[model samples]
Target: MEELLRFGIVGCGSVAAFHAQAIENTSGAVLTACCSGNPQKARTFAAAHGARAFDTLEELLAGPVDAVCLCTPSGLHARQALEAMAAGKHVVVEKPMSLTLEDADRVLAAARQTGRKVCVISQLRFQPAVQAVRQALDAGAFGRLVCANLSMNYYRSEAYYQAGGWRGTWAMDGGGALMNQGIHGVDLLRWLMGPVTSIRASVLTRAHAIEVEDTAAALLEFENGAVGTLTGSTACHPGYPRRLEICGTEGSIVLVEDALVRWDLPIPCPVPVGEGANSGAADPNAIGAAGHTLQIANFVDAVRNGTPLLVDAQQGRQALEVVLGVYASGRTGRTWHPETP
Candidate 1:
């Protein structure tokens, strides 16, 4: 029998709970330890999850674990993943893999150097609707993508940022609405549209007092001659489901909260409809374990079977570059092209 891969959860914040539930539900993995800056919080979270608590990441690194699940702030992902990879542990990072493209590329380079498998948590890729689109794309149903648009016009209350010290800072949380909240859809847009050749964008802090923008908008030109727009805002009061619309020469589909609200494809392409984990469009921490569960399970299987990951470090970096390009375009007021590392 294959040994169950023991896991460690670093940064015992709210996002770690989804990982905790996922480890419990995963067949080839188990939660062995967890770490948090606050000893009391670490102990409490560990006690609740049947894992040993470590007060520091260094201490956790010295302990037994096959992989580390990084649930830290958005800005810390690259550094943490590199540290863990250097320490000989696989890593799984939450979205916006890093705040900057430089950081994302650095992490990717380190992962390659260490030969440590690193996966980013973009669980929407595993969602059924996304899966269907991927399949149809493979089948030539969506021939030559024409245009794509993604929006995350959801709400996040002031209390939401006030709940944690690291919530709305530029250093840790990175950008506000787009970087922190809407990145998943941003990634989905890039994934469906292919690599971007250029982008123009603007970001604002219209509604929040944070160091980052509460709203952002971008226009992108893909390598395939397709153009797209992205709108991400936390100022959308009462919160609506996040939406993604992909238009191709032959077909188009619209998704709201990972659900296919519209499906129009040429030919007999049937999109399989199924529920994924709650993506926490409104509540940042209200995510479910199913998507995380599937991603982590697939990661473990990749480890055990030497298979390719659905979202590896390169894919993660590409998504980060797309988001960062928007920021650059916003600052320069000129279209920016992503620099490949």
Candidate 2:
């Protein structure tokens, strides 16, 4: 049997519970400690997982742990990840890796310098349906890729933003809807379609009275000549199912609510199925937390067997680059290429 990997979880919030459960359930991983700025929450989170609690990350890092899972605010990701890496702990961080590309680069550099593995929490990639779609695309089932469309229309009440001091702020959470919620779909789009060459975008705060834009739409031209449109927003009432559609000369595939809602093509596509996989259903609340266990499972395997990380730290930064490119394009009112930076 592989040796157990002790894990220290920083940030004892709602999302932290998911990581705790995932670590507890995965083989060769033990949730040894939990940390939070709030002492009470940290204690509660640790008790729930049968682990010790610390009021700060420094205390958690002082414990015996092989890795740290950071579920902190988006803006704080870089600093916390770097600290964990510097402590000689492997890190798995929540997405949008950092608020800016520079911070993202810093985190990546730290990982390299420390010679420790760093992974970004992009659990959407673990969804069986999403994996199936990626397989089809990789197998050329989507012959001669043409165009793609991605939409993320989710509602976040004022109470949601006010839940945490860093919720809707640009400095912390990066952007509003695009950074917080739509980033998964955006990353999935890029993962399946390939690198974007240029982007033309428009952004606005349509509904939420936040500093960042609550709604954004963009057109992208891929280096491979494929065109795509992306819409992200928190403006819709009650919200709607996030959807991603990719079309090629042969046919198209649509994934709605994490499931393959539509698959129209003549190609013999093989579906890569897995056990205990979440059915890609359309409940907004259901999809977000469902993939954590699978993600942890994969991470533990990678740690033990030296398997490649499911979502490497650099790929996470690349995904952030695409989102930032859209913002840059929106600001400049001109198509921006990700490669330029």
Query: All models: lDDT?
Result: 0.85, 0.83
Worst 10 residues of 1 by lDDT: 268-277
lDDT tens per residue, model 1, 1-341:
88999899998988899999988999999999999878898999999999999989988988989999999888788898889988999999988788887788788889889988999999989977788887887787877888888888889998888887787798888878878888788878878778899999988888877888888998889898989989989988877778788888888888877677677888653665444346576777666777899899989998889889999988887787887888889988999986654
Whose lDDT is greatest here? Answer: 1
Report the CA-based lDDT of candidate 2 relative to the real structure.
0.83
Candidate 1 to truth, TM:
0.96
Model 2: residues with Cα > 4 Å off, grouped in runs? 269-285
Backbone clashes under 3 angstroms, per model: 0, 0
Best by TM-score: 1
Candidate 1 residue spans exceeding 4 A from truth: 269-279
